[model samples]
Target: MKHYFIAHKLFLLFLAKFFLTYILLTVVYQLYLGGFQQNQIDGITQLVSQNTQQLMRVLDMDVLVLKDKGASVMVFYKQKYIARIIEGCNAISIIILFVSFIVAFSGKIKPTLLFICMGSLVIYGLNVVRIALLVVLLDAYPEQTAVWHGTIFPLFIYGVVFLLWVLWVTKILDYAKKTV
Candidate 1:
């Protein structure tokens, strides 16, 4: 095992390859999830509907509308977009799945399974941060919310993901020459 970690320099190379693959897979997955994401939206809507008052208490936002926006329920809180919960499966979940899939692909069988489980958890945390930032933007700059949620946040999150992959490949995978 020690020899496998040290002498097998090719393993480091393979790890870098796997890390890059994971990133591409994750981004592709995110793009897919960027689509409607109906089911997740629906589940979240249902939960909110059931605990509407509790949600109001939690967010301190007054709900003014809960009408059918064609296919989805457009819930307006304080004249801002609290949420738009859709009704079926959407592309966003695919992002989570893809990130996990690609990381898993790096190691088949046992290794894949472990990486998928870990990667999923990490991605979920990142997703929550993404949502939180969107919510903040929605509250702070209602007019420019679209710019933040749709563009800025994606770039920031992807940059973070890319940096993470770079760190994993160069530092964790022992591919970089140590300076210190």
Candidate 2:
């Protein structure tokens, strides 16, 4: 039993860290949502919309983002509304999950922090691009909007995160073991 506990100590620590970080971040996010004005959109959602709109502009697409009814924002392309972005679409929850996983598999303190920051920025950037491209895809294939948004795009984001995890475990964490 003693040897078993020694061997599995890191795994136990990972589980505790993951759950504590996840729970704390979730509570903070919930509190933020609760404080929003009745009909006003949350800052994160607005930021995502704004970033997506900027990306669309860079791609030379006619895109407009505007506040919709009751805490929702709508995306318009070529004068037609393409999609509505709500709180759930903001990517905060996804980021929280990503951060939790990375922290769970933490390496050295400095490297862990740096990886978390870079990984989160990558996730955020990808999420914005995902939303913009999804809007464009939906505009082009109206009949496949549900498939694209609900299935394909989600898989893309999660797939990226999974790859990141693999990279972290095999590269960053493995490197730490060699140095130690």
Highest TM-score scorer:
2
Per-residue accuracy of model 1 over 33-131 as CA lDDT, tens digit each: 467444344443344343443445467656543546454555565677665544331223534534543453243456445544655556545654455
Q: lDDT value for candidate 2?
A: 0.90
RMSD of each: 8.2, 2.2
Q: Kindly list the per-residue Cα lDDT of model 2 for residues 1-180, writing each as its tens digit.
A: 999889999778989999999999999999999999989898988999999999999999999999998789989999998889999888899889988988888878999899889988998999999999899899999999889998999999999899888889888778456657
Worst 10 residues of 2 by lDDT: 171-180
Backbone clashes per model, in order? 8, 0
- State each model's CA lDDT, in order: 0.53, 0.90
List clashing residue pairs in candidate 1.
29-95, 30-95, 32-91, 33-91, 33-92, 37-90, 38-88, 39-88
- Structural similarity to truth (TM-score) of each candidate: 0.48, 0.91
The regions of model 1 sitting more than 4 angstroms off are 1-81, 85-112, 175-180
